[model samples]
Target chain A: MTTVPRRDRPGFYYPKPPATWWLRRPNYVLFMLRELSSVFIAIFLVLLLVQIHQLSQGPAAYAAFVERLRSPGWIAFHVVALAFALYHSITWFNLTAVVQVVRLGERQVPPRLVAAANFLLWGVVSLVILFFFLLGG
Target chain B: MSTRKTSEPFWWGLFSVGGVVAAFLVPVHLFLHGLAVPLGWIPVSPARIQALVGHPLIKLYLFVLIALPLYHWAHRFRFILEDVGLHALRAPIAVLSYGSAVVGTVLTLWVLLR
Candidate 1:
């Protein structure tokens, strides 16, 4: 599935790929998994919306929501969601070099340096948010 | 297909912006809210968090955080469907994919702004 099968012309060849084509190759499988990460992240967003709604219902409702989230099932779901969120973040940040090019004078920076810079920024941002969450309040 | 005439670039631009936003922010948000607060790593107080959420800057931040990554998901998920042999159903799938993101974005706005 590297290249899409174009629309079949009158006499041209366009092989009909099976539904399981992505499963045949490890890279394709990995790609599909990465795409799938969005689904989990989107669901996580919906859960967040629900959480905010709970908060809007005042302290008691928010506390009840937190209590429900503390259950084993919700905690397990969160674990999986966090795993996918990390996967999405790592892959997205790793592609920064390919997607964005930085220049020093007339020369382009090395891809490794670009990727490293992204990772470093990610760490700083994560630390700041963590600080806010853990202590700012 | 004339790419210039259509709105693909607009969505792609959003996808790129959303990619940057999600890559930088989502992981930390997930870690703190999903695991830390729930599992007792960080203290979970409803009033404290509510107070934080009530701030205008935090409300705007929340709106951006929840809305942008949605477009990223929509664009990627659309291509994923196309690549996996659903290229024939491109029209409806594109609608459903982006339409859901649009809905999610509206929902986010309603929740955050309210």
Candidate 2:
């Protein structure tokens, strides 16, 4: 009788499933969420493009587009899309610190720091834009 | 083993720049769509949009804001897929992401110029 290697043996002793297909990894769930958010991003882009096209056409066309956006159905769509986009943005920003190869002379900067900085910078920029728009000019 | 940096420079550059742009642009986007409109401060009108985009400085800013961030987001997304061991899909995803950004840039430039 041929004996299989201990590591290769399929039994309860294995840390993971013998086959990749049988594993339900947490990373898989994350990947799905990230990819699913792309659909929302696409939808948002289409809406923006349509608005841009209308803006180019003249006042009446633009007005019609805006009116359409104000409809309850469209507003609901925007709300859902915004939720997805926000989730995507937050997740992606957090991942940035991990994937980028950042090194210091001796001590490496923490990934959490990078993520925090990103969020802080965003907050500041948003405030600045809001200030400008609200204060006039 | 090949020592050359496997990552594409254009894509990396886009990602870096896009990260910075997105950091700023996203907040502005939220404020514009979320706060301003809700507060009844700025009406969504063609004249308002034209005035916003028509200013030379604002036009330049918008171009950078829209193009760079999209490119950045796409590149990051491709990397996320790669990290998940979806290596087989890498090439196709990279091409699609970069191609879309290029097309978006062209369209945006056309709008700004016209």
DockQ of each: 0.74, 0.26
Candidate 2 local lDDT, A1-137, one digit each (tens):
22232333344242222323313778766666665565555445546656666777988887777767767786676677666667766876788778765678877788888888777876787788776655442
- Candidate 2 per-residue lDDT over residues B7-86, each given as its tens digit: 59878898778655654565456446533453345755446667776789977876786667667667767766555455
Give me the TM-scores of chain B across the candidates: 0.95, 0.80
List per-prediction Cα lDDT, in the order shown: 0.84, 0.65
Q: Tell me the TM-score of each prediction against the true structure.
A: 0.92, 0.69
Writing each residue's lDDT as its tens digit, candidate 1 over B1-114 gives 333478888999989888888888988888777778877788767888988888999988998888999998999899888777787799999999999999999999899888
Q: What CAPRI class is candidate 1? A: medium
**Candidate 2 clash pair list:** none
Docking category of candidate 2: acceptable
What DockQ score does model 1 reach against the true complex? 0.74
